[model samples]
Target chain A: MKFKNNTVTLDATDLKILEALQKDARQTYTAIGKSLGMAHSTVYDRIKRMERQGIIKKYTTVIDAEKAGAKIITAIMTVFTDPKESENVAKKLCLAPQILEVYTSLSEELLIIAKVIAENQEGLHEFIACSVAPLPGVLRIRTSMITKKFKETQFSIADNSKVNIYKRNP
Target chain B: MNEKMASRILRTLSREKAFYFFTSIGNYTGESAASLRTFVDKIREMNLKSLEFHFYRGDFEKWIAEVLEDKELAEQIGTFRNSSPIGESLKNELYRILVRRYSKLKSMLY
Candidate 1:
């Protein structure tokens, strides 16, 4: 059914396609069809439509940094800005390898978060020392190491009250 | 394995505590033991109280150096760096373990 804010209507099959892609974007249309009991072309078309609608984004592999022998370090940085310098500072922070995500708070706090995997303690130290600490506009940084993983999931398409498009198409 | 070896490990870690255990684990075998011990030391030193471990790709040093060293890989690295977060629930588990250890020590002192 259509979203309340937007008039776009998506069916059960569309939901299934979105769910599958969310879990593993690299999943082939043939594979998705087998899971959903649909033809391969149908799945392909739905995915294309989803992309055109701006619902589904790009696909890539998720790696395990610890297994890859990269030391993972995280830091939540706070920055004080003249507001105009915010974009330039964010651009610089975005380029650092250690930084994973940057969030600009409505309270005007620039939250810069990062993760880094290094070969050894020395490597990790150098990465932080040279790469991250040098970024402009960073006023403070609270660094921590990730010792475990909890929840990771793709988008869920279950918000719709009812899905009845399959019958109409059949 | 004998109970002696197991007891030996527990005792060494218990006696040494923070810095001692980290030093001892360098020569320790077993992936779980080595990594766990090192992680424990970090927790004690940083006073994090909680932590979580997750697997992610890309090297921090390699990515930064690649940006400076090679431009194409830099773009690919940029995309990878944009998404990755280890949440609070996992961190709390590690915190519980550390707090339990600290409490046990406090009991021993009094």
Candidate 2:
């Protein structure tokens, strides 16, 4: 099977390798080769090719926030500003350490959902008031504390299934 | 989808200067705990600058019984719930034991 993304075409073996690494990046090339019934060198070569193609950006470690002693807060912020100012405001929000995830909503309103972490409620408030709220074009910021996390996982190749490959006529 | 959610949570945690732990064990059951347990165990190994535990008033024991469905585990956690709203020591001890248990179980399977 050939998985094509724009101009890049990845074979079945490549997809399998990506899936394996997505599960555990620390898995040795030998271990991955054994599982996939390929040689260690083959696994190495495939990974190298994928990296060069920019499919695999970087390896990262995942940490648990609650166990580490920080409070998790999720906020849905709606920025009431000029259409031209939206991009600037989003860029500014990205620079703050406390602002975790920020993405624009599909609706007309410039809505952004951000995940923030702080030592406590007071620290969270301070971050929003002093740092985030003051950014140009940021009109209002509403935050809600994340009381519990039911499920969480790192990025995996499985998500690629949702991508639409068919092109539509303009 | 699950991995994305976990990644977002991890990214949020990584940027913090202080360490904090939060888990809603009651929302998960057997297999779902795998990723959560792995993440918790990994962070525990890191030498963080500061460590704290955050929780709702009585969520600790509630999670054990309702989510894990383990009466014994809930009883063990209940002993720690006797204190205040945010019991740092209790949370730390409970997490340590849980992480150890999960790690041991995982090793046995492999």
TM-score, one value per model: 0.45, 0.53
DockQ of 2: 0.01
lDDT of 1 by residue, A36-85 (tens): 89999999887888778777766667887669876544433344443666
Error of 2 at A58 (Å): 1.5
Which regions of candidate 2 fall more than 4 Å away from where they truly are?
A1-7, A69-80, A159-170, B1-110
Candidate 2 lDDT (Cα, whole model)? 0.55
DockQ of each: 0.02, 0.01
lDDT (CA) for every model shown? 0.47, 0.55
Candidate 2 chain A has its poorest 10 consecutive residues by lDDT at: A161-170
lDDT of 2 at A147: 71
Residues B8-54 of candidate 2: C-alpha lDDT, one tens digit per residue: 32232211222222222111111112233544554444222112222
Query: Model 1, stretches more than 4 Å misplaced?
Result: A1-9, A24-31, A71-82, A107-110, A116-129, A153-170, B1-110
